[model samples]
Target: MAVEMEEKPVIKLAAICGSLRKASYNRGLLRAAMKMCRDSVIEGIEMEDIDISELPMMNVDLESNGTFPLVVEEFRHKIRGCDAVFFASPEYNYSLTPLLKNAIDWASRPPNAWADKPAAIVSVEGSGKSGQYHLRQIGVFLDIHFINKPELFLNAFEPPKKFDDNGDLIDEETRKRLQDVLLALRAFTLRLMKGKSY
Candidate 1:
């Protein structure tokens, strides 16, 4: 007699980078996480990035008609459909970048898409941990369920070797931490789906 093996559901995660620069280290870190997910390192998980650069600044004037821009709508749709979120923040002026804030503002409007979704944050910063802190504060208002352990606070400046010359994340230790964060996020999301609280 052959026993049937139960199949695990594929968890979809959406990643957002807080920087728009072409050579942003935060983006590189995000890419590394994505590559790991693509390689099936996380088991039954898929990850993709939703670009926030195209989102226009949050302006109430633009929403006078009670409609979000096409790009903003698309962003909200992606977040709403994903099982979890991953944010790679690059500290700017001791805080999250305006680009990322704008994207969040758009999504936090009516029918908040970020609500109840398990989230994780990683940052490539010099010394300021404010960016991650600010993200967590915002998560409170957005009702985002974030994994609080194993926070990835990588210092790209003082590191012996964080990224390669090509801006790819080459540090094995950091990569391992990122993988752990993703795994935690996967478990966290599954728990929430099963009506369990963190």
Candidate 2:
């Protein structure tokens, strides 16, 4: 039996981009995704950007009296509330960015916001895709379930020039691929959420 929209649980996806560059192509991918959701290019999912740029570098000393800093608390809260995660990861020395690692570390503390959550990753990079793999490895300990197929890794400097000067996706083909990643993430998230109250 087909599930009605109202009966099926609404999937919430929260995205965090690795690169903090103002005109980063990775950030552009995430922006395109939010636009697609707003325009109904993808259905049954509500996507939001979770800012990790403001997150401080990990320091055990930052924890005071069993409480985190205000910004860390807010970031952890958002990750905890989302049904799944979308990572716009860009390679840096064949691994995830330090900023992203910091965010994950904060959230993976006592309560572990990422535990048992479904996740998907998209990237725009030079050559090495090892960054994506590095993230998946981290996900193992964090319990972030990632969808295996339909991975997105584009050459941002390729001939077509898929993004504009201000870091917005400008090409239709890349937009479609981004949409595909979102749809797959949504489906995988729903599958994990089935028969359970999240």
Candidate 3:
């Protein structure tokens, strides 16, 4: 007897963080996201593997030279290759951290790569409210089809401690939140891919 197989939808997601620190809460949140994503429609790409520190800021000379920094080029290529993005950002003085902002700036240069992509934000901070506003501002400017429902904010740094060093999510509440965001993001990504507003 032959068995039928389920068709898995290909949904690529590029994840970025607001901190370069090895132990950053934002990166921890990204790890949680990776844990939650479904195998059927999720492919999570972390930014750490792509070196962005070598890339210069969005400068005229860089473009004029017709040269693409391997890191920046990989960044844009990932964005272009993906169906959506998941930004795991930390709050810095009630704003998105500079590390994440620089990433956006670099990706949004002339010949932008972020336009019209469906995106979502999952912020982890000592205080959740502050991160909300910060992500809102970024969503507005990026023109991404930001998922409005099931917004996630890991308010306290303590929650991530439930997970192990291997980046597994252990806290029940945090795990549930991760599931909620993935479902919401999947719906949002599907809506955007279908050319419908959600």
Best lDDT among the predictions, by candidate number: 2
Q: For model 1, how many clashes?
A: 0
Model 1 Cα displacement at 146 (Å)?
A: 0.8
Residue 99's lDDT within candidate 3 is 67
Question: For every model shown, what is its TM-score relative to the native structure?
Answer: 0.93, 0.94, 0.79
Which of the two, 1 or 2, has more TM-score? Answer: 2
| lDDT by residue for model 3 (132-175), tens | 57667766787777888788877655634655554445677876
Judged by whole-model lDDT over C-alpha atoms, candidate 2 comes out at: 0.90
By lDDT: ranked, best first: 2, 1, 3
Top-down TM-score ranking = 2, 1, 3
Candidate 1 Cα errors over 4 Å, as ranges: 1-5, 196-198
Prediction 3 TM-score vs. true: 0.79
Clashes of 2: 0
